[model samples]
Target: MKPQRRLRLGMVGGGEGAFIGAVHRLAARMDDRYELVAGAFSSSLENCQRTGAALWLDPARCYASYQKMAAQEADGIDVVAIVTPNFLHAPVATAFLQAGIHVICDKPLCLNAQQASQLAAVVKQSQCQFILTHNYSAYPLIREARQRVLSGELGEIRFVEVEYLQDWMSELVEQTDNKQASWRGEPAKAGAGCIGDVGTHAWQLASFVSGMLPQSLSAELATVVAGRALDDDVRVTLRYANGARGRLWASQVASGHENSLRLRIYGSEASLEFQQENPNQLWIRPRNAPAYCLTRGSGVLSDEVRTMGRVPAGHPEGYLEGFGQIYREAADQIWAAIDGQPFSGSLLPGIDDGVAGMKFIDAVRHSSMADGKWVDFSAA
Candidate 1:
């Protein structure tokens, strides 16, 4: 075995006050798998320069626009991390993929299903890896829950309930100076409201853990906040292909809830529940048996799940570490691809998952428009 090299990483669109951009940089740096060599941190030249100075990157490496960055830094960048708004995701990702750079993009894939398919095709042609940042799926307990479900400990899953609630949009914050809220509220920028922003996350987490995708769905989307164009609340019922049923509720107007993401799945013999707010514990209720908790770094966890944890049992690990796990696994796949080594099972969401999410978003919009009539969903 030999020492591995760090991937040269470039970023797009995480300037001052951008929350998720900092999260991506932190995740990429957490495991030392990638180095932030360059970035087009903002559309404005001044902001780009300021962000570059703040990150201590060489001033020459920061470009004013992603187009210039892609053209100029093509030879230097190994992976391009796109943390821009939803509308820019497709164009930025396509530009870098065409430049032969691998892409690690923030979620919802793109603004629409057409863009999703187009990017998927480009990735296949370029043979560059595309990793979608569905970060919740990387949690250690999520991995364990997935393992236990797959191992038949749950004995045929019957129902799934997933909700992602937040109070950030309870009022008309977009009318104020909230940068994050402003962009997400606009249909042109975000594509969809709560459904695209956090609903996709809830849907992805459920699919990741339950190993099932919805066959059909009926959705009700509402813009509860006055003067808002896009939806602020969403409720959907999912019918899986295997006869399993699920319900999902994603809302930014749920008062007093901040980043409350929780998932519960009930099977014939037992049930499992995990909450992002309390990420370390997984509650398991077995039929005719006492319910118990599965904690990260514990003896009962699978080897694969244990490896995702960084500390000893009972010590807490949260969002940053979970995000770091995805970064770690993505680095493995990218390195294997570059070295011509065989990559096994997927540890991170890929182009297919991105497309699937877009389809889910598309279906939700369609179903809501059709007065909550059932709409078929296929991840193909």
Candidate 2:
């Protein structure tokens, strides 16, 4: 194989004090397949300049707006990672895709399904890869679980239960000086609050692991925080195509919890359980048999999982490692497309995953407003 060229990456949003922007940079650098060449670090010009200088980025490559950055970096940047707030995702992504750059975007693709559809059209027209960072799907054990279900070891999955809960905003943290909680609690910046933020992760993980799309859903949303415009908690019940039933709950106001993402899948012959806090191991129980614990680097793991697993069985790899896998796989696809070569392996989450997530969010929002009635997600 010829030596792969490093992709020149431009970032939109993710300035000082932003959570996910730095995470994207770290993930991209992990595989050494991409370089951060340019960025519009923040919405404000001064912040963008300060952030650029802090990162040792060239002044010429940093811009005040994504529109200017996209036009200027079109010939240089191979990919653009959009890490801005939810409302900016569609516009920034549209700008880059229109300029012929592949996009690796954060989840909850856009503010609405219509915006997601517009972005999808651009992606199709450009024929460029659009990777959605559903980072949970990159976990080695999660990959193993997916393969097990596909291989019929689980024997027809029938139910899925996914929950992503956090206690950060439980008690009106947004009223204080917490930067993360402030904008996230605002309806304009964060989109649909908990449903658009963490709920999308739970929804994506359930579908990614189960290989099923939600057909319809019933949902309820709550604003536990006083004076908050958007929901801080969400509960959704999902109906899948193959008669599978699933439930998802995401809350920033769940007391005593912090980034606790859990998934349980039950089938006719077996069941599997995986948790984000304990990412290295997966619990598997076959019908009428003893329960088994599968670790990331163990002999019981699949080739795909093993290849992605970086450490030994006793050692641990968590968020950073899983995030790195997503970036590496994305880089593989981007580089393949750039070099006019075929991609090597599957990367589960893509533009379609983004569309599905946006549809899920919109459907749940509609369902909540409709007195928790079932809403057809297909219409999204």
Candidate 3:
């Protein structure tokens, strides 16, 4: 198939001071698969205009609200990236999808199951693709780990552990001028603090690599920071359908840690570990053999997996590159669907993955509220 032009992109939120929005912009452009064309960058018109001017976007294309952007740019851009707060995720996505635009949304899907149901319905009725940015799963070694497990290298899975820790909110940062912290520390905006923020990422990573969603879970959710309105620390025990058990921990108040997302999977025959801070290596411990490390650039990776990186091994691609892989995959999938051609298969996260994350979150919240009782995933 002949190569096509870059997908024209638009964004909502991530205006002047947002962090993740800039990350999304960098990642989307890293693989040269997308070109941002417009955005409703902020609720404030001045901020939107300033952001658009900085990006060299047409001043007219920078709308004051997402609803206006969705209406006017509906046919102008190929896809819209949703980088708004958690509470706005569902509605923003719904508007774009209803306008027949594809979407690349940030994680935790939405605030709760009710929003999930509404967005799920919109996704089903739309013809456009939906890509959720579970960027961790798109890492090179992480993809290899998923392949290895799916190919039976792990035997029957027995244990899974995922812990995502950060210390950015160790104090009452929300009480200050921290823009990200202000909304994130609120239940209305962030939904569930560390659980919705990082716990879902951990859960998604476990399920992505291990290919197992728990049957039920017992959880303890706590607001580790004093005077905080939302839970910042969480521990959950997972029970898989095959009797395999798992543990997940996410905390924004974990001191001396920054983006310390890590995972370990133990099966009948061996165990594997991956740490985000390292990003370039995976450690495998076999039952009978000495454990060894798997690096990102190793020849062990398939041709397809290696394409995720812009440079060769030892160049050290981390968070940004992992996120770029998602954008690249979304571009490929969307182009394939448009061209009526069979293209490379994808493991891109979609609406179902988003819904699963929501349900897991709901169950965890329920279990924690019910005195750490086991809450079935089915009821979520």
Candidate 4:
């Protein structure tokens, strides 16, 4: 294969000091597969120019609005990354997709299923790659877990449990001018607080590893913080078509925890556990046998599993590396299409997964709104 030029990348958001935006930029740069060239980094032209200059970008490429950025960069960039607030995701993504450019979007898809459906149409019409950044599933061990479940190493699945917890929003951080908390505390900008932000992540992780989407759900959403507008705590019970039962709990006011995302899956023959904080290790316990652990880059892992990690054994790679893997995989598919070739099958997620996540979020919201009543997942 001949060497190709780096893909030109643009952004809709991720202004200075924006946490997730910075992470996205870092991830894109990690594999040296893409180059940041233009963006509508902030609504304020001053902020946009400031960010562009700080990143050594050509100031002419920094626009005042996403609409202009999309139109101007349509023929200049290979892809655009959508890292805006929840409410803007759909429109920003639609603009870039309509411009015949690929998209890398931050998750929870959009505000609701309607927006998801609308984007689905745009995605299909454009025939452009739309990658959803469900970065957790890109971790080497997480991929290995998915492979194990697919290979029937876990036998008949019986149960699944997942949770995501964080303590930063335990108080009224929004009132203190905390950017993330400010937008998150408002439903208009955030859609649904903790549930959309992290619960969707837990839901996706469980489905990704277990290879199953639940058939129905009963959910309860609570605003643990006194005056919060949206839920900061969410609990959902899942029933699978194959008789598997699952539970998911996501909370932003969980007191002592910080990014404590965990998943446990139990099957007739074995069970496995993964904790995001302890990302390097995966524990497996087989019935009537000793439990063992698999660490990232472990020599015993299959060659495929080993490729998920960048560095060799004994090197710790977590959050950033996991995100980098997603970007790397996206570059592969994007480049394949650009070269007018049939791409090899890859696990990098796309539109269908995004739609499924939105459906789950909507189902949980509907169930909670109806007093924790069961909602058919099929209807979602």
Candidate 5:
């Protein structure tokens, strides 16, 4: 296949001081797969201008709202990266998808399942590529874990445990003009707060590695912080249709923990573990055997996992590189779409994944409200 021109990418959010916005930008540019051409960086025009100027975007292309950006760039931009708050995700993604532009949006899909369903419809009707930025799924070791699990290296998966913990919201940071925390803590703006934020990532990571979806769930969602509206902590049990069980625990008030996302999957024959903080190494333990560490960029890595690593073994490739992998995969799909060719083997999360995430979130909330009843996950 002939190499296509670099993808023309636009942004709907990620203005100044928004952590994930900068992350999306860096990820998009990391592999040279995309060029940021346009953006409505923030709701405030002044902030948008500042962000546009900082990103070296043409002033005329940075609009005041996502609607204008979508309408005006419909013919020019090939992809729109939606990095706004959770509530804006559905609307912004819908507009871009309707405009026939592919989308690379931040995760948790939308504010709720209804919005997720609506956005899923838009994506289906438009037939546009929609890539949800579940960056953790892009890690090379995580890909290795998925491949190993699929190849039966770990035998029958019996138990899975995943946790994502952070201490940023342990205190009432939302009350101190912390823009990220402010919107994130608000139910209207962030949907389910910690659950929607990092919890969704945990959910996606678990499903991605184990290749199993929860059939039923019992959840306890709590607001650890006194003044917080939405959940700051969550603990959920997952029952898989295949009789495999799992547990997920996510918290923003886990004091002293910062970005401590970890996954442990145990099978009848073996087990595998991976941690986000030490992303370069994956642990594998066979039945009655000592644990062994597998490092990235090693010759032992499978071809698929090897391709995801940019540097050699000792040099670390963490969050940004993992994020870039997702962008590269999305770029491949986008080019395939443009060239009218068959697209295959893409691991990037799409609209269906987004909807499922919303449903998982809804199930958690409902189960919590119902006193931790075993809620049917399919019904979510």
Candidate 6:
């Protein structure tokens, strides 16, 4: 097969000081798979023009609105990357997908499950790919963990514990005009603060590792910051189909912690633990044997894990690398779809996962608001 060409991409947001936009660009460029040809960087036209200049995009192609960009870039661009706030994800993605372009969207797919379902329907009708950037699932070690659980290496899973904690919003940073914090704390912009922000990551990671969706969930949400509209901390207890139990805690109010995401799964025969801070190692303990440490590129890794591990042993592959893997896989699928060829491999998280995340978010919020009563996640 001939090598596929780079994708022509456009961005919906991620203007000045935007966090995830630059990361998306870096991940796209890391493997030479996508070229950001245009963008509607911000709501402000001036900021959009400035960002377009900085990105060296053509003036005519730089748009001030996603609707205009989608209509115009439909014939030119191959894909659109939506890096906007939570509320904008569904509209932007729907526009691009309706325009017959592939989409690479950030997580917490939309403001709610209703919008997620609408976008999912569009993705199904359009022949374009919709890749969600739940990048942690692309980590080599994470792939290994998923394989172990799926292959019954850990026997029948009985418990799952996952937590994602950060201290960036420990105080009222939004009151001080912090751009990231300002929009994120606003319910209109971010949808659900830390729960929608990081809790989605926790939920996705757990489901990714276990290959099981929660049947029901009971949750508690708290806004520690005075006058904040959304929850800054969330605790959820999940019930799985096979009678397995899980607990998830996601918080931005954990003082002194910075992006601390950890997961542990226990089964009848063995257990596994993975820490995001230490991405390269996986701890495994058998019921009657000594605990073992497995590194990313070790001999114990499966073929699937080794395929995702690009660098040699001892080399650290962090967030950007994992994100890059997702982009690479998406690029492959996009190219295959474009060329009408077979692409016979998984492409990390996609639109289905996005729908699942949004449903999970809705269930969490409903469960919390109902005084921690069990809410059926599958109903969403």
Taking every candidate in turn, the Cα RMSD to the unseen true structure, in Å, is: 1.2, 1.4, 1.2, 1.0, 1.0, 1.3
TM-score of 2: 0.96
Which portions of model 6 miss their true places by more than 4 Å?
none
Candidate 5: pairs in clash: none
The residue pairs that clash in candidate 1, if any, are none
lDDT of each: 0.91, 0.87, 0.91, 0.92, 0.91, 0.89
Tens-place lDDT per residue, model 4, 1-380, is 53378899998889986889899999999989999999999999999999999999999999989999888898999999999899999999999899899999998799989889999999999999999999998999999999898889999999999999998899989888799889888888988789899998999899999999999999999998898898999999999999999999999999999999999999999999999999999999999899999998678777887877788777888999989999998998998888887987678778899899889989998999999999999997
Scored by lDDT, model 6 comes in at 0.89
Better of 4 and 5 by lDDT: 4
Q: After superposition, how far is residue 117 of candidate 3 from its true place, in Å?
A: 1.4
Best by lDDT: 4
What TM-score does each of the candidates earn? 0.98, 0.96, 0.98, 0.98, 0.98, 0.97
Residue pair clashes in candidate 4:
none
Candidate 3 residue spans exceeding 4 A from truth: 342-344
Output the lDDT of residue 302, model 6.
82
lDDT value, residue 272 of candidate 1? 97
For candidate 1, write residues 50-150 as lDDT tens digits: 99999999999999889989998889998999999999999999899999898999998998898899989999998998999999999999999998999
Instruction: State the lDDT of candidate 6 residue by residue for 1-380, as single tens digits.
Output: 64556789899899988889999999999989888899999988889999999999998888889999999999889999899998899888888889999999998888888888898898999978988999999998888899899989899999999999999988888888688888887788888789889999999999999989989999999998788777899999999999999999999999988999999999999999999999999999999999999998789788867877778899899799988998888988888888898777684788899888888888888888889999988895
Worst 10 contiguous positions by lDDT, candidate 3: 337-346
Give candidate 4's root-mean-square deviation (CA, Å): 1.0
So what's the TM-score on candidate 5?
Answer: 0.98
Clashing pairs in 3: none
Clashes of 2: 0
| Candidate 1 positional error at 284, Å | 0.5
RMSD of 6: 1.3
